[model samples]
Target: MKFGVQYYPEHWPRDRWAVDAKMMQRAGVNVVRMGEFAWSAYEPKEGALDFTWMEEAIALLSSHGIRTILCTCSRTPPPWLYQKHPGIVNCALNGNTQPTDERYRVGLAHGEFIAEAQRIDGAVIRHFAGNKHIVGWQVDNEIGASNDCFCPRCREKFQEHLRQKYSTPGALNEAWGSHFWSYNIEDFSEVPTPHKRAQPLVEYRRFMSGLNVEFSRWRADLIRELDPGKLVTTNYQNIHAQHTDCHALGRTVDVNGMNHYPARTPELAIDYYRGARGEVWCLEQHTRLQHHDTPAGRMRLWAWMAIAHGATGIVYFRWRQCRWGQEQFGDGLLPHSGEENRFYGDLSRIGAEIKHLGDMLAPTRPRAKAAIVFSYESRWSFEASGFDRGLGPVTEAVDFHKALSRRLTAIDAMDPRENLSAYRLVIAPRLWMVDQRIADNLRSFVGQGGTLCLTTASGVVDEYSKSFDTPRPGRLQDLAGVTVSDLAFDKALRLPLASDVIPDLDGEEGSLLADEVHPTGATVIATHAAGWRKGSPAITMHTVGKGRVVYVGVRLSPEAVQTLTNWLCETTGFPKPFELPNGVSACERACDDYTLLFFINYRDDPQNVQVGEGWIDAFTGESVAVAEVPANDLRILRSGK
Candidate 1:
């Protein structure tokens, strides 16, 4: 329940430090994250380094009872270092070296660059190793926000990584299935740069993602060695961010952190990052409007939404907007005039509320009965193949997650390889790429009394992006009890569904992609009601050991997805609490002592909810049978001993 803001003492004049600190303290901000982007300010020249200003700033903030989330500036090195090591520039996909004017232009595998980065990072950590005001370390500012380079050195390193992984050239060839276009390699070095091939492109993505993970781990380990008392973390961009695998990167830090923009990003992103690692933080929570105008109270509501999704701390992006740079128009709590506005008023109100809530919400966690599996490999593979451009894996996953949100059930969105034994229901959307390991995991989940639902375009390729010689779903056909004969790709196909099986899904329209599913041992729950493929199986269900599996062969409408999800919840006996009205959402976090419910009204009009007698509002500490929450507002209630 900590509230904070991103601050940059180096960006402003020396005299403004105490002023900003006093203002933030009055606003109830307990923390300030700084220095992840101030490399040039710290070291103006190549061999010249000074940290006196940073120390002075830290001391000033500490006097006001504000801690610091210090950050390593390896992401953006000073200009002198780049000029000294000109070869460290990244090689773009077009084979030209990217200029070093912008940040993140240095190649990850560059030897000289890595040495210098490590030196600077070690020096920075050693300087503040025992500082009491420094509470945590942010490894880097959005590590791998840009794609990695494809230089010869990186290629050589990737080949070495493959050699270390495969042990032999023959194994590498088999794993990548490089024999399709005479691309088979006799030596590990023979693997060419990524082209139009799916396997190589997917492997390159994995390799680049690994480079990011290794880089973050390097800095995190350095921090641990120098400052073991402080926590280390880095913010992930989003779920569809292809530059780095966040789930893999989460392992390098003590806590998972995310840059959240609820106006543009989905609720699934918050839940995904929350589940990626145990405790999460909104490192760069949105304060100002981006792309769209944020309503008066929506900003604070979004902050609470992050907390409801299990974020331990919420740090707004910035205290004031910059008057210069590319993001000059990017708004913050204070406008360019450095005066408070409506947004600052909203922040002040929420800050007081959070102060009142205090540490009472710290021990609770989001107890979820359903989970959605999201795979980066599958998403990368799908994007590489360019089979269906409009059908994104992230879109499908978010759609299902939104449906679950509409039903007032908190979901754990994470990688498919994560543990699925904790939940009663699991949904995997567009799992286009499946390996034997993932297949076994899903099978085990279904076999152990858990209900599993898989959407269209699932299991179309193996681990190496090669189509299975057998059925379409690769190793999941037997477990799913269905095989695909032909895939319908017509965008205009609004095929009707059967009415009797699920009455709510009756006559629902299906579009985009549809598979002609031939069931082997599964029961055909729904079939096409129109066109030439009339009465064909569009959705099927199979009963396994102690669980059940449902295969959705067509992309159904949003209404249909919700209906199917509701039916699945009912069939699985997972509770779907608090039927929310339109434009309203609710999520719950609980412990043995009590359950806290967060009700948010996203609509422009106020909404009312009927609560039981035992429920008490956390903010107001009032017991009531009914609660009226204003538009773009939120309420937290504690119930059940």
Candidate 2:
């Protein structure tokens, strides 16, 4: 695996470069990611470009056995370019133009902006095309971190996009179901920027979200055309930033990559970005959160967590804290005064450990027999509906993933459209909108002997963000063998629910929304214990073809959900391979030669995991019957297959 640090050579003096390089070499950081936000430094004035400094920096690092992953500097344009073309400045949804001084916020789809970005980007690529030590190219810094523009130009482009998709205003109106408040339009140009309205909002969300993918692909293709051999990728924004569809971006790039903050972002994000590609580079691993100090051991623990979830590369976000900037007290390997602290100690330890374990760990990817499906369209649809809006589709997916990961070795967080042949149990939570393709894919999975679990508030709308004329649970009713009669979504109105398959919560009142499910030919496994809707089915199961479909008609607590996942294994007749203690997890990764399991303890103290037999410590090469993982640390065990 590539062990590296994100270095900003422009931020420091030329003389200090050797000191940082030597420190990196001492710590086993073999690669450095630079130039992510150094456009101004590259081109001090428009048309006055100099790549000599960066070349010197790369050569300096290379002398110490450290390569570079040069990032295209287009994301941070030089000040002069913006001063020349003020029209490219970003505009918010409220019609206010954002200041050009901002780093990432820009009118990404603006014509002049694209031209300028491409100019600088093309220059950077051509300048570094022949660098032998460069291992990869990050197209842009963090593609989805910027806000989507709502300027007049974006309005025009959205209209053209709708015109191409719908072909006619009438068809667009029909698909959007715009007749509710006479929101119908005669021309595609009549559509306004997304601020109100359901259908248009969802379409706008999708359209604007796709711009990130389009932009990344443009850069990636440019890199391949100019510098072809190395990998091309873009670090995605934090998982909570739903502005862009990550799965789509992952598919577009040559390799999937992400900026991961382990403290703030959930661990599922590491697995989510890994997706079908099965490997992701954690481009920006956090050492601290927003000037606050992270716990002593967490930085190393988070790195191992990423590696466990199939991170082929771990590049700490930065090498040094900036002396003066908006992000002054930021996460860095070294403090602002270039002083070594506990962070450096933690960093050196991780570097030393990965230096020994990287080869065996990097070659192996995560393995999962079960998956939790998430959809951007479904999430967008829920956003359009503007109802029952508490925890959104993302929370639902993450929660289910966490619950399953607790019991199972590793659980995949996948897009519904991805391949389902490899998984035996697939949990799709809150599938609010169902397209023909989505419905067909899910139904086929159930038909092909896959246990599919779906939740409430699903199947209310079609792909076009219009209500389905059919019964509730729209396209999945037959496959699920249950039709939703009605739903109760009052957060305070917790119904007393009981389940035979899941553990009892001692009248804790977990089900948030109760769907009065009327099963056509399925078994009712759970029902309302005591309520106005008492005896009504809250959960159901129906055998379909060689498999079955379990329908959760209500949102249950995290504990209840995990218990239900256990029941899924029981029904599928597949025993869970191993179970770890709470606050500890084991991820299985393997190749043709061997299988490895990384036991990670998330608690504050040490924890032990049973290794059974035939397993040797990956680093020590000593057989272990029981492995004790340090607090916020990990132990890797390898077995020849």
In candidate 1, stretches whose alpha carbon ends up further than 4 angstroms from where it belongs are 276-278, 388-390
lDDT by residue (tens digit), candidate 2, 355-458 = 88777776687777788887888887787677644556677777787777766666777789888888899988888888888889998888889999998888
Model 1 lowest lDDT segment of ten = 573-582
lDDT of 1 by residue, 1-641 (tens): 65899998887898988988988888888898999987788889876789999999999998998899999987788878878988888898877998776778888889898899888888899998989999999988888876488888888888888888889988878877767778788898887778688888888999988888998998899889878878999999876577888889999999999899887788889998888354588999998675567777778888988988888889998888888876678757788776778878877887888888877787788988789896888888988987754586788878899888876547888899998888889999999999988999999999899999988888999888878888767689998999987777776888889857788888787899998898998999988898898888999999999998899999988889988988887788865456577887888887888888888888889998776678888866788567677888888888834
What TM-score does prediction 2 earn?
0.97
TM-score of candidate 1 against the unseen true structure: 0.97
Q: Which stretch of 10 consecutive residues in model 2 shows the poorest summed lDDT?
A: 503-512
> Whole-model lDDT for model 2 versus the true structure?
0.83
lDDT of 2 at 382: 85
